[model samples]
Target: MAKNLDVIEQTTNELTLAERQQKKPKRKKKKLKAVWMYTLLSIFLVVSIFPFYWMFIGATNDSSKMFTNPPTLLPGDQFMTNLTNLNESIGIFRVLFNSLFVSGLYVVIALAVCASAAYVLAKYNFKGKKFIFTAFLLSMMIPYQATLIPLFQMMSDFNLLNTYFAVIAPQLCFPFAIFLLRQNFLAFPTELMESARLDGASETRIFISIVIPSMRPALAAASIFLFMTQWNNFMWPLVVLNTNDMYTFPVALSSLMGLSYIDYGQVMMGVTLATVPIIAFFLTLQKQFISGMLGSALK
Candidate 1:
């Protein structure tokens, strides 16, 4: 009886120790997973923020110090000087105005044309509608580069080269905007349209008052995209515009690079200035941007 009791006590003790050991491994695994999560988040945060840091640092350093073997990683005191130089070199306000004008015009026209087309495709039934939509989709698949030559030729023939209209007109026909607006319109409540029509509302009146108000999120999203694309456009403008007075921000910035010397500080300042409006625009419409994305996703 004594031997049996001793064996039972030993087995109970061993089982308890085994349970404790298993608990320790599970705790260790949880800690390791937490550490890994933190490490990955830290890396992502650094990667996202580093470019802006370098840009600010470069903006505050002179050209010589900027390209040194060990690049400057901190801010210097040359910011004002760089700003003045950039303004003097390229009439900063004029370039900004040109960019804004072209981009704004493109956004307005694009929204009108695309949204109208999308409304028709979404709400109305006509022969060959699917075929027409398929053509638009195929057009989207074709690279922009492939269409550049033909577009340029058409512009040249129309004598629209070097004009703001040249840039604005082409962008008004964007297929992506058509597709986005169509998708949003498809998801819109048709009962609202029916109610408006029954109340003796004209099609144009209904579209202007009811449809547009309801589709604010989609319109805002499309406007942001159209504005950004027109603002950053470089190649087409470079080929078309020959006068310095008509130069947009991106084109003017390219002039900063010359055969002899390149102004790093001034370039950085210009870039920083260019990026500010876009950031501000996004911040203003961020709520709509998020809602539009979520709405599209849900649909």
Candidate 2:
């Protein structure tokens, strides 16, 4: 009986030791996996950041040095020179103002129009509502390239060429904005709207006083999207605005590329300057942007 007991005790100790040995490999494997994931993420981050770094470097280097075989990785001391050259080449402030005005106007008008339309689609029951919503979704799938020629022709017929209004007016009908606003509206609590209505508020009042206030984050998100789209707009503006004085920032940047004597440093400086406002805007509204994204996922 004693011998049998000793053997059982020894067997149990060996099994425990084996189990610990098995767990050790799993723990090491988990650590290795974590390390590999981090390594991949770091590589991806570096790849994404490298272009901005190169752009900054280019802004500091003269044209001759820009394409040097051993590219300058360090920030050079020529940033001021580049800035001066850029200002001399073009009135940076004027171009900047034009971009801001166009983008800002588009953001406000597009968001307002889209939000109203979205609210109607999401809340109101009407004949052919499903069809209309389906159409809006279908429009999103259609590439903008397909409509460019027709749109350009219409603009030509309207004689809106070279006008900011031309750019702003056409984009006010964006289907994507409508869809985004609709989704946001659908996610909104109907109880709030019902309460407002019960308080003898008019439909418009309910929308303006109750709905709009609650939709601040969604509006912010939409505004950012519209602003980015308009600010980065190149093709339509290029087609519509023929003159340098009315050129948007992107158009002006393109013009810089065409000079018989191209200046890489000055071009980079303009790019940097042009990007600053967008970055600043994003930084300021980042909280709202995040909230808007979260709001979308609420329902």
Candidate 3:
């Protein structure tokens, strides 16, 4: 019996050692894989951020240095000069005001219009409902350039050219906004709306007091999209707006280019400034935007 016990103990110890040896290679491979992944991600991060860093460097340096051999990797001392030149070139304050005003107002009005339209489409039954919704979706497939000529003609005939109205009017009934909000609205519980109705809540009250509050995340996401669309709108505004005073950031930035020479420093400065508002806007609503998009997808 003693001899058998000793042999079994030796066998058990050998098996455990063998098992640990087998796991060692797997653990090493996992660590190596993780190291490689991190290294690749670090490379990508640097590559992706390099352009913005270069832009900043350009903004702070002279135009001539932008093309120098070996390139200007560090920031220089021309930032103030570039900003002053940029202001003189485009009247940055006025251009900023125009862009901000148009984008802000568009967000507010478009949100209301889209949310109401989406609510109706999502919850209400009426004649030609599916057709109207389908039409909106099909309109998304149409090239925006295709409608430009007719929209321009219509705006011209209405004497809305060179006006903020022209800039804001054409995209007020944004199909994509309606569609996004509609999807989120569909995810809302119909039973809740019914319960509110049973308690003497009017449709308007239910929408204002309950629906809108509950859909804040969706609204934030949609507002970000709308704000970005109007803020970055170049082609439509370029076609309609003739005066420099009415130009938004994109149109204003383009004016920095010239046939004779381009001021890279000023151009970079303008671009850097123009990027601030968008970055700020996104940062403000990023949490809600993520939640809204994820919630809608899950629902």
Candidate 4:
């Protein structure tokens, strides 16, 4: 009888502990998950932003201190000196203008062409459509370097070397941009398009009034991508532009590097300067860019 009583008490205690465990709220677990997510995001953010911060800091220091044993994390006292030296050495304003002009024009014209091509390919039934799209997809697989020599030769034939047109023309028909816009265009409702067609709207009118307005997010996203591509482009500009005055920002920054005795501070300053416009551009369109890309995923 005493042994039975002890067994009964032990079972009751076990049951009570189980019940208490089951009654506990899950908020602590949820908080833990949130903490982990925030921690990861904070780490990633720091990793992404640190390089740019280091570049800015390096810009402020002279060459000797810039590459010290521990490496300088703090801004030094040479910001103005570097800026003045850079300005006097290279025509920074002219280089900046060249980059801005080339990038902006490329975005505008590239978007227009890519959007129109994507719209037609997505909506209109035409001969060789599959073949054409397949060709574009295949073209995307061709590395840019593979076509460099041919493109240079063609540009030389047209006597367009060193011109902004040479840079902008070749990139106008970007396969990836067309593919992206086409995907977004494919998501539009057929019923709406049919209704618009029944209303006797011209194709151009339908595209401008119906399609373009509906795809602002995609357009904004593509614009940012295209702008950044042209902005940070180094190789093509380096190869094509021989004149210092005509050189884009990336090419000009590279020019600051000497075979012997590279000026670390001046180069960093150029990089910092080159980076500002891109940062400003991204910030300006970040909302639209994110929303547009996310909307495509939702579709």
TM-score of each: 0.86, 0.86, 0.90, 0.89
Better of 3 and 4 by TM-score: 3
Best lDDT goes to which candidate?
3
Over the stretch 235-299, how does candidate 3's per-residue lDDT look in tens digits? 99999999999899899999878798999999999889888999999999999988987876776
Clash tally for model 1: 0
Candidate 2 structure quality by residue, lDDT tens digits, 1-299: 99999999999999988987989989899999999999999999999988888889989877678877787788888989988888777778888999999998888888888899999999999999999989988988888799888988998899988899888887897788888788788877899889988889999999999888888888887888888999999988988898888989998888888847789998988888888889988988899999878766665
Ranking of models by lDDT: 3, 4, 1, 2
lDDT, residue 294, model 1 = 90
Clashes of each: 0, 0, 0, 0
Kindly list the per-residue Cα lDDT of model 1 for residues 156-195, writing each as its tens digit.
Answer: 9999999988877776878889898898899889999999
Candidate with top TM-score is 3
Worst 10 residues of 3 by lDDT: 290-299
lDDT of 4 by residue, 1-299 (tens): 99999999999999988976875556668788999999999999999999988898989999788768798789999999999888877889999999999999999999999999999999989999999999998999999999999999999999999999998888899999999999889988878888999999987899999989989988888888899999999899888887999999999888878898888888989999998998899899989888887886775
Off by over 4 Å in 2: 1-31, 259-261, 297-299
- What are the clashing pairs of model 3? none
lDDT of each: 0.89, 0.87, 0.93, 0.90
Supply candidate 2's per-residue lDDT for 71.
Answer: 77
What lDDT does candidate 1 reach at residue 219? 91
Q: Global CA lDDT of candidate 3, please? A: 0.93
